[model samples]
Target: MDDVKQNVQKVPKRKGLSNKGQENFWGYVFIMPNLIGFTVFTLFGIVFSLIMAFTNWNLMKGLDKVQFVGLDNFRSMIGDAYLSASLRNNLILLIVVPITLFLAAILAVVMNRNVYWKSGARALYFLPYITNTVAVSTVWQALLHQTKGPINSLIARIFNLPMKQTPGWLSSSKWVLPALIIILIWQALGYDILMYSSALQSIPADYFEAAEIDGANAIQRFFYITVPLLSPMTFLLMILGVIGSLQMWSFVQLVTKGGPGTASYTIGLYIYRSGFQTYRTGYACALSWLLCAFILVLTLIQWNGQKRFSID
Candidate 1:
C-alpha cells in the first residue's frame, strides 16, 4: 500500500511536469510565425543595411564588386549641402510638436467633461488619425492650392487680402514648410487627444476632489493636479513626436516634393533621394545609420530625464 501511494504521487508529479512542458510548447508554437517573420524581415534587413553603410556598393556594379570604404561614406556627409538643408527643415518642423500637444491636451480635457455628443466628438477628432495618409495629403493638396484653395479663399475673405497677398502655400518656398507643419499637426492631433483623454480618465477623481476642498480653483487644480499626473503621458508623446518629426518625409514628398528649391527637404526624403533617385546606395545607408544613432541618443536622453518629471 505504501509503495502504491508513492508510485501514484510520482505519476502525478511527472504528469504535471509534462503538462507544463506542453503549455510552453504551444505558446512557442503560437508565436513562432511572428518570431520568424521578425527575424527574417526586420532583424536581417537592419543588419544588412548596417553592413552596407560601411561599403561602397553601387547597385549597378553589383554586390560582387562591393568594396569596404571604411568611413568614406560618413565623411562625405560632413559638407553635404542637401543634408544641411534637410536638417534645418526638420528643426523648423519640430515646433509643430509642442503646439499640437498643447492643443490636444486642451481638447482632451474638454472632451472628458460631461458634454453632449461626447462620443461623436471623440470619433471626429480621431478620424483624421485613422484616415489614409496619401488620401489626406491629396485632399490637403487641393485645399492648399495657390489659386483656388479654400484656405486662401478663407484668408482672402476674412482679412480682405488680395490673391497674391494670401500666399502660395505649397508652391512658394517660404510658406511650404509652414503649410506642411499645419497639416502634420492636424493629422497628429487626433491620436494625441485620444491618448491624453485616456490618461486623464486613469487619474483618480479623489485627487481633484481633494484639491477642490483645499479651495483650489479650476485652473489651479488643472495645473497642479492634472498636468503633473499627466506628465508621463506627455513624456511618451514628446518622444514619439520628436522621432516622427525628425523623420518627416511623406507629407513633404506628397505636397512640396522638397519645395521650390529643396527648402522643405527633410532627412528622410534626402535619404530616399540619395538611395533610389541618385543611386548613392552606400551613402544613403550611411545616412540611415547616422539617423538611427541620432534617434537612439535622443531617446536615451528623454529616458534619463523622465525621472525628473514623471510622476510614476
Candidate 2:
C-alpha cells in the first residue's frame, strides 16, 4: 500500500509538469510567426539601411564592393539650400497639426452634442478622408485654377470683388505650400474629429452631469472634464499627425511635384528624388535614417510624456 501511494503521488506531479511544458510550447508556437516576420522584415530592413547609409551607391553601379564614406552624406545635407526649404515646409506642417487637431476637437464637440443624424454627418465628414488622393487632388487643381475657374468666378460674385486672377496654386511658389496644407488639413480633419468624438463618448457621463449641476457651462465642462480625459487620444493623434506630416509626400507630389523652386518639397519627396531620380541611393538612405531617428525621438517623447502625465 505504501509503494502504490508513492507511485500515485509521483504520477500526478509528472502530469502537472508535462501539462505546463505543453502550455509553454503552444504559446511559443503561436507567437513564432510574428517573431520570425519581425526579425526577417523590420529588423533586417533596419540593419540593411544602416549599412547602406555609410556608402555611396549609384544606379549605374550597384553596391558591388562600395567604399564606406563616413558622415559625408549627412554633412552634405545639413547646409543644403533645398533641405532648408523642405525642413521649413515640414515645420509648418508640424505647427499646423495641433491647430488642425484643435479644430477637429471643436467639431467633434458640436457633432457629439446631437446624434440624431450621426451616420450621415459622419459619412459627410469622413468622405474626403476616404476619397482617392489623386482624384481629390485633381479636383483641387480645378478649383484652384487661376484663370476661368469656378473659385475665381465665385469670388467675383461675392463682394463684387475684382477677380484679377485666382492664385496659381501649384504653379506659383508662394501659394504652393500653403495650398498643400489647406488640402491636407481638410482631408485630415474628419478622421481626427471622429477619433476624438469616440474618445469623448468613452468618457463617463456622470462627470458631465456633475459639472452640469455645479453650474459649469458646456465650455467649462469641455475644458476640464473632456480635455483632460481626452489627453491620451490627443497625444495619440498628435504623434501620428506629426509623423504623417513629416513624411508628407503624396500631396506634395500631386500638387507641386516639389516644383515652384521646390518650395513644397518634403523630406520624403527629397529622399525619393535622391534615390530614384538622382540615383543617389546611399545619400537617400542617409536622409531616410536621419528622418527615422527624428520620428523615433518624437514617438519616444510622446510615450514618455503620456506615462508622466498618467502617473502624476
Candidate 3:
C-alpha cells in the first residue's frame, strides 16, 4: 500500500511543453487581453484614420457615403490660412524647449548642492507639472487678467506706471504667445529639474574633484565636465519638450481659444477645430498625418544629431 501511494504521488510531466515553453505560453495567455484591446482599439484606429484621410467622410453622413478623394485633402492644406498660422505658432513655441531645459539645468545644479529645504523645494517645483491642466490654466487665466490680475498690478506698482501702460497679457495678441511660453516653461521646469537632478547624482564625484584640483572654476567645471555628461538627458528633454510644445492646445484653447486673430493658434488647436467644430473629418485626418510626419522628421533629425553631442 505504501509503494502504491508513493508511485501515485509521482505525476507524469506534460508530453511536449518544456518549462520555458510553458512560461512563454502562460505569458502570452496573460497578455492576450491587452493585445486584443490594442488591436481592436489603438491599432485599428490608426489604420482606419490613415484610410479616412484619403476619403471625404463626414460623421453626419453614413459610412456608405464616404467619397474617394485622393490627394485633394492634402492639396487643400497648402491654401489653409488657419493651418499656416497654427504651424507658425507651433514653430515659435519650439523656443520653449531650449529655454526651459537651460533653466532646469541651472536649477538642478543649484539643488544638487547643499540647499535649504531641498525636498520641499523640489516638491513645490514639481507640483505644477502634476497639477490638473484645467485648474492650472484657470489659475493662470486669473493671474494674467489684463486689469485685475496681480501680475499687471505688481508691474504697475513697481514701475509706478498707470494700469493702461501695463502690458495686456492674454488680452493682447502681442503678449499672448509670450505669456503662454512663460507658463509652459514654468510648468515644464519641475520635470526637467527632477530628471537633471537624478542624472547629476549618477555622475562620479571624482570628476568634479579632479576639476577642482586642476583649479577649474564653477562655471568652467559645469561647462566642461557637467555639460558633456548631462548631454544624453538634455537630448531626451529636448525631444520631449519639442513634441509637447508642438502638441500644445489645452492652454491655448482654455485661455485664448486661438483668439486675437489666431495669434496663439497651435497645430493641435487647429486640428481640434477642424475635426470637432467644423466636422471636416477628412481634412483633419490629413492635417494630423502631416503633423505626424513633421514630428517624425524632427525626431529623426534629433536622433541623428545626438551622436554629435551625447556622451553615451
Which has the greatest TM-score?
3
**Model 3: lowest-lDDT 10 consecutive positions:** 8-17
**What tens-digit string does per-residue lDDT give for candidate 3 at 146-264?**
89999999999999999998988988989988998999888999999999999999999999999999999999999999888999899999998888787887778987899788899
Error of 2 at 28 (Å): 5.6
Candidate 2: residue pairs that collide: none
For model 1, residues 4-123, the per-residue Cα lDDT tens digits are 866755664444556557668779899999999999999998998999999987766779988899999999999899999998888788899889999998888878886799989889
Off by over 4 Å in 3: 1-21
Off by over 4 Å in 1: 1-28
Alpha-carbon lDDT of model 1: 0.87
lDDT of 2 by residue, 89-157 (tens): 887768768878899998888888767898798888889999988988899988877666687678778
lDDT of 2: 0.83
Q: Rate the local accuracy (lDDT) of all candidates.
A: 0.87, 0.83, 0.89
lDDT-sorted candidate list, best first: 3, 1, 2
Cα deviation at 223, candidate 1, in Å, is 0.5
- The per-residue C-alpha lDDT of model 1 at residue 106 equals 84
Worst 10 residues of 2 by lDDT: 11-20
Candidate 1 clashing pairs, residues 3+ apart or interchain? none
After superposition, the stretches of candidate 2 with alpha carbons farther than 4 Å from their true spots are 1-33, 159-165, 300-312
